[model samples]
Target: MTKTPPGLPLRDYAALGDGRTVALVAPNGRVDWLPLPNLDSVPVFARILDEETGGSVELVPREAYESSRRYVEKTNVLETTFTTASGVARVTDAMVTGVAGRLPWAEFARRVDGLEGSVEFTWRISPGTMLGTRSPWLDRVGEHTIIRCGQLSMAVVGSDHGPASSDPTSADPAELHGHFATTAGSRHLLVLTATEGEPLRVPDPAKVDEGIDRTIDSWLTWSDEFSYEGPWSEQVQRSALALKLLIHSPTGAIAAAATTSLPENPAGGKNWDYRFAWIRDLAYTAHSLTWFGLREETHAAISWLLRTIREQGPDVLVMYSLGGSTCAGVVEYDVPGWRGIGPVVTGNPAQGQLQLGIYGDLIAISRTYVDDGNLLDVETARLLAKVADKVCDEWRSRDAGMWELEDEQHYTSSKMGCWQALTDAIALADGAHINGDVARWRAERDRIHDWTDEHCWSEDLASYVMHPGSDRLDASVLLHAPSGFDRGERMSSTIDALTRELGAGHLLYRYSGVADEEHTFVACAFWRVSALACVGRHDEAVAAMGALVTQTNDVGLLAETVAAGDGAFWGNLPQGLSHLALINAALMIKDLAPKEAHDDQ
Candidate 1:
């Protein structure tokens, strides 16, 4: 098989989401990656993976043009401006939201507002299913153009003219190409509505236009509730907006990231689907949202997570499907991966991995919930107690660390996480939030802490090693300083050690061994920032944060990883964990910085 040429840099794409699904719009006006109906659904446009056979929705200029884009203030609505010698045009993109909740049908609206001299705008809709397993066909329903593949159907409406070209002679007959010329003061609108199992609803043009207004209004209203007024407030709000996009409004589950199978390592084989909600990521998201005074999203996310745990009977998997069901098994695609990184796979096998850090995550979220004055329902309380018991029973056993390493070890970070979980559990039990063996939890928590201090710390290295018997450094440990596991000189020294060993300027790899293989994990860098502030390295923390925030894409979205050498983005788009980390780190600096720092700003 021949490799497809690389697409645009990962930073060149901005995301648009309406609580259910996301579309990655390229600077060149192509909707290259969109999973219809839901974030985890089979892609209807997968050109980001296989640019050759995979399809896209293009609304690009016919001539070369300089482009720039940004999200409308406090919203996910994306506006891209193309400037050419002859003319300038702006395309406003949004996934039209409903008045009450998620719209019954998925509607992606793109409005073109001509800003200057005449410019020819060309567009095409070519649909493809997951891994190209299903073929899409075009059918004209009255004046509406419908594209159907298996159970999914999409209707293209709103443009005044019909498709300029259709491959009626081809077997699949999916491509619908068209073009229109617009001068200054002229405007055109295109809306694509996707539905599954139900009959296609070709939305009226005027209704779609109104829906766009409602979507923008809804986002603005949500933004109005933010109470953050600290350093980097704009970036914090933008990150919060990005995180809001990942929230599945129907179920309140927050996906780890919006796209699937974006490579972490430039050489490939490290790609995994991040569209499902990880318990750890959800807990972090809730914690960050709570700090921002965004109680609704935090409450909704925790409620959904607890409900899922209760239904699953407390033997919590690492992650769950957005609908709170068991995730399907991993399946490899026959297509080339992003940028010819081979073996594009869907579904994550890490769903069942015993990542012991989740115990700490759940307990941290529970602590935040109760501290915020929200009482836990009986079922959730019981679930928390049961999970705490499991942590107590399993803390001594070797398990996967937070990095989800394949080799199970007595990871020091995992032990610290369990220590954190049991400590919080005892606190909750004492507070009457749940009934548990407080005495036993206290004993185990102390023992875990003592064991970590004795074994994890390396006097030789002057830092905590990855595990008891290993010399490797893992960035996961940096999280503990802010988690309250260790905030003393030891952690301070560990921060220095981590920066000396694993830090690539302000970026960091997950562990020592993978530095040559994968991009630096963006979340870890932010964790370091938080760790620095925790240890009272205020100047260093502020400087580090300044450098890290500069890594965000043009529209303020961060991917999962970034190239250590050049700071280019890799991995999943609009990573929730990365954004959560950024928000938390900014808040940490704000709280820890001396009064002079704030006065200086």
Candidate 2:
């Protein structure tokens, strides 16, 4: 066995996928984390989540070699090149695609082609079913192969999960017969489709080929909708693709990330599972999706979210599983932590927190929907009314803020949310919505705004404090600009205070240095960027935005936070909130860019 680098090394994984599922490809050519059928489902290949029992599918060059990898231009197709003493070999990985309504199927595909000289490689495939609970029983069936285990039966061809060896000829199975040479130019393919206990259908190779072509075409076609013309176009585009990969296609809900329990800090107890969808996250996602002209995704996320909130009643939970199921109870998994981040946990404790700001996020989304010509039904209106009433009754009550901290307090941002929810609700009633207490809402809205100004603002700190009677400054309040709460002199002052107190190098901490050594909140920085753009600080905002993009991994993937000292990625990776904030900040800055610049070129 090759000795892994110390500190539970991840082997430098990158993701590739169709819209449905993602595969995390490791540096040594092993696919470590893959959740089939859906993003939130139990992993079918989960070595990253559990290094011992969790299985993986690997492709390794037969000789000693160096390797480098990148995603293909403007697409999710991953290309990894392995260079041996003789020459280089490139392996491309992608998941096969299907139409929106196509059910009961999905694909994982790989193509290996030589670049220069004869290079040999080996392949090892071991699939862990349902979060490593079972291993598939593979049996050869003519040209095709079958993996039967429990409720899932899959037919695969072109590759087999055999024994592990760096040599190509170590263990030969019928399904494992792809050869690589300098001039041979061999083509090999492996696809796994979920049959879901139904009779398995053996399709022809030509159909599979067509599916691959159509999948590539769909991604290329969908990517054209992005209208960003920015300095880091490639990084922005890859961020968009990673966001798409994290989205659950069946319901159009974007997951927070592909894998969970990936740790906020390697040794810190900040590990969180982000596969669930939060109301705040969904709203941010919808805002970005709409700006990108993906109305379908926007509408789907909004509709699903609204229906889910309706089912869960007018009160919104902090988050929900991808299927809108509220069964996420945080449990520590019986496995080693990622990169030695102990206590790999599932479920989020924040799900049960009394986050009063969720109502504001919901109302913000609904207001945006109305702005986009989508009419609000009576049910949504009634739900908004209940939320507004709750805000009116409890704006001053102690509860967790947007950060989901354990210590409930009269969070200033939560107070701002009260103002936002009522403000948007009143706007909704004035439009085509049903009857609501517009006068009462307005009265309460103004009251909450005044209360925030009186109690939340601190003269000594020269910014809005984290909570009432506290001098601690929170970076979250920087969202006041996007929330339309404060602008002009007050906004400028708050921005200056935040820059002075919370800023470290280029990264912004969630609060002052006193807040438990928190990781530099990546999304909060983006929020600062958006707020700066809103306040007409275009040059600084663009520079900050550019710096934020630089913090991304080589593939333009971001974690929930980036360590300030060395700028290493930390926290949950490929974070949806970070991407969502990026999309909004990009648009906000674009809108603020001088029109003369548009006319100049």
Candidate 3:
């Protein structure tokens, strides 16, 4: 087996998903990170983290090769072409989707077709167990090979020559392997099916080939529904597709990202598990989906989010597991982190932290739903009103800011978020969606506005500070401009201040003091684009939007963060918030463009 080169940039991987789970495929033809059976499931292949112990499925050329890859138009199917000295070949990878909804079985298929002279190809599957809970053993069941680890079982069925020799007792065990020489017009297919409870029947190779077409058709059909016809339309559609891959089909709970434990700062210690749902992320995603007229996905996500809020009641946590349960405590693994950044962790500890900003997220989602001509159900309306009341009561309290900072304060953005929540609640009440104390909400909302103006803004800094008594600038405040917090001179000046302080070209960090520590947050940069458009900085917004979209990988996927120096992606893959921000910013740019420019398109 070929050793994976150390320190592979996070941007080098492309993602594939069936709206259930995702797989990250590196440019070198390795399936580096995949959580089989479910998005939150323990990874069956996690070479993205610990390359030694964590397993991977590789399909690489024997000879030295140069590679290029792209997603098939209007779909998540990845086509990577390898050009070696002898010949060229293309590998198409996808997580097979069912005709209607998600398939009952988790399926990943790869097809290689030769386009030139004969090229030698090698492939292998290395099964891994989760956190050492169970031992994985390969058993040859009739004509197929089954890798079983605890409750999860994966059946490997494909067209290949045979298994290659490998050490059976090693930490990195290869369960199956094969090699073959292919010339022009040659075709090969590999399908991996996984199930949680029971073993899967070995699938026919021909049927797996058919499943590939069906999956492609499913993605194209979904993409066809997108109504965007504006500037950056292609990038917007790709971002929308990336966001769709993060949605859990059965539950409508979209994960923040696909992979977890990829550090925001590669130097060490900022890694986070993003394979779960956050209220803020889901709200942003729902709002973005609504812009494209994707009512089914929007309603599904809102319904799931509302149900989660209703279950948690007045004291809703900041985030939840993908299944809508409370987040598990953080558990550090001995597995070496991506690029040896160490202390890879599962689960988030921020669930217990008080984040008053989520109230705004919830209310924003409800307002979007109501504005779309859909009335909230009785339970949802009541839950939203209860959340609005909680926001009113807790607007003055110090809590974690939108960046989830450890040092709690009366964050300027958080206070403004409360103001937004209360104002939205008054609007909803006026619309008669829920019975609420609108008079009290209005008074508290005004109070928040007054407090923010008095304490958060700093004449010395010439803009809104991070929080009361601090002069740090935060990119999060830019979000308020488009939300209608202040569209006049103050907000326009805030945009300029953020551009001067937090901005690194078109990208911006989350806040002050972390520029050298973490990568620039991609969502924060997109927020700047929206703020610029709102404040009539049309040329700047267009230029900034162009730069931000170019930061995406070749396949048009953005991560949570990008390196400040080289524009390399650092955090989790295909972040939901990043994609949502991209969509929103693109829409804003199109909406704010001059009539002649829009008509020309």
Candidate 4:
């Protein structure tokens, strides 16, 4: 057996999904990160987080080889080609879907095809411990190899295109194994079918293999619906496709990112579980999907978000599960994290923090929905009004800002969010889409605007600062441009200040001091694109957007952060906010307004 490399870089993984759960396939044919049943659930294969006991499906050429991969045109299905000394093999990987949509259970398929000459291969299936639960064990029902982990059961099936070998059930680290060789035009496959608390059903190996093309067709059909033709059009479409993978089709809830604990700082304790749906992300997604005119995901996401917020809210939350549950508790494992960065964790602590910006997120979603020829349901409208009222009452208090920091303060961005929320609420009330105390909402909105101007703006830095105490410039304040807080002299100057303080070439750190501790936030740079266009810097926005799109991996998927110095991916895979920001920024740049009209508000 080839010794496992100490680690695989996050950039080396490609994502595949069925709009249900995501699986990250490493460059060398390893299924490194996948959560069962759902994206936020305990992972079935998570060698990305915990290298040793965190299991993976390993398939690699038996000889020294170099590999390259790309998504099958406009689809999430990945095709990786391995070139060995004597031959070549192509592997197609997908999380298959039925004709109707996502399968009731998860189905992951990997088809191996010989491209030239003949290539030898080996494969193994080792299901790991269920997060904090008992270790998995293998069983056999007829010829199917079933691995049981906690309440879940997975069937690992393979078909031979050559002679094979299998491990005895007594094997400790792995119980299912096979080896084979393929010549030109030859085909073989390995399929995994999983379910929780349901009857185990093993699929015919051929049918599972055929499901790869079926999944491809499904993704192509979905991708064809994207009508966006703009700057970064291909990346925009790919971002749309990547964002589609983060949508939990069963409930229409969008996860912030696919996996957890991938790390914003590899050497520090900044790794987080980003598998839940943040209200901020939902609002951003709803806003971005409008440009593509995708009705299903847009409506489903908006409806799911408001419904979940209504069920669990009077005071809004930062995030909720794809299943709409608000009860997420943090759990840390005793396993080594990515690259021996220990204390890998699940369930973010930020869920319970009072992030005041969620008010803006909810109201921003409502505004976008109504503006797009849609009307808010009466209950949803009422809930939004209640949020407006709460914002009016609580805008004075300090709370966790959009960054979800432990140090609660009246962050300028949070105040601007409150301002945007109340402003949008007044518009909704005037349009009769929602009923709110317009008089109070307007008064509170103006107060927030003036208060932010007086307290948050810094003469020394010539920018709206992170908070009153510090002169640090925050990239999040760039959202003020789209929120219509200011797109004039102050905003333009602030953009220049942020570009100098937080910008790292094409990327930008979240705030001033974070450059040394963490990588640049991917979404922040895209926000700079939108803010630039909003402030009449179209030439710069065009130039900036040109550089930022290349920051994504070759497969066109982005994580939450990127190392400014080396362009390595950080945080979690297929980050929703990053893609949403890309889509929105591209559209903003393409439809940028007359420069004269945007000059100095």
- Among the numbered candidates, top lDDT falls to 1
lDDT of 2 at 469: 82
lDDT of each model, Cα atoms only?
A: 0.87, 0.74, 0.85, 0.86
Better of 1 and 2 by lDDT: 1
Q: Which stretches of candidate 3 lie over 4 Å from their true place?
A: 1-5, 129-133, 160-174
Q: Per-residue CA lDDT of candidate 3, range 113-195, in tens?
A: 88999789898888765644456787666765578877778877677634554467866554777787778998888778889
Q: Which stretches of candidate 4 lie over 4 Å from their true place?
A: 1-5, 161-174, 593-601
> TM-score for all predictions?
0.97, 0.91, 0.96, 0.96
> How would you encode candidate 1's per-residue C-alpha lDDT over 1-601 as one tens digit per residue?
9964678789888889988999999989999898888888888788999877778888988888999888899999999999988899889999998889579889999888889997888888888766778878877777666788778898777655335578788644788888887789987888888998887777888888888889999989999998899889999999999999899988999999998888887778889999898989999989888877888889889999888877875488899999999889999989987888867888998978898888888988998899988898888888888888888889988998887888999998899889889988988998999998888888888988998999899999899999987888888998899888998999999988888889889988888888888888999999999999998899999999999999998889999999877778899888999998999999999988888997887
Candidate 4 has an lDDT of 0.86
In candidate 3, list every pair of residues with a backbone clash. none
User: Of the candidates shown, which would achieve the greatest TM-score relative to the real structure?
Assistant: 1
Query: Model 4: how far is 107 from its true place, Å?
Result: 1.0
Backbone clashes in each candidate structure, one number apiece? 0, 5, 0, 0
Please give the lDDT score at residue 507 for candidate 4. Answer: 86
Worst ten in a row by lDDT for model 2: 159-168
List clashing residue pairs in candidate 4.
Answer: none
TM-score of predicted structure 1: 0.97
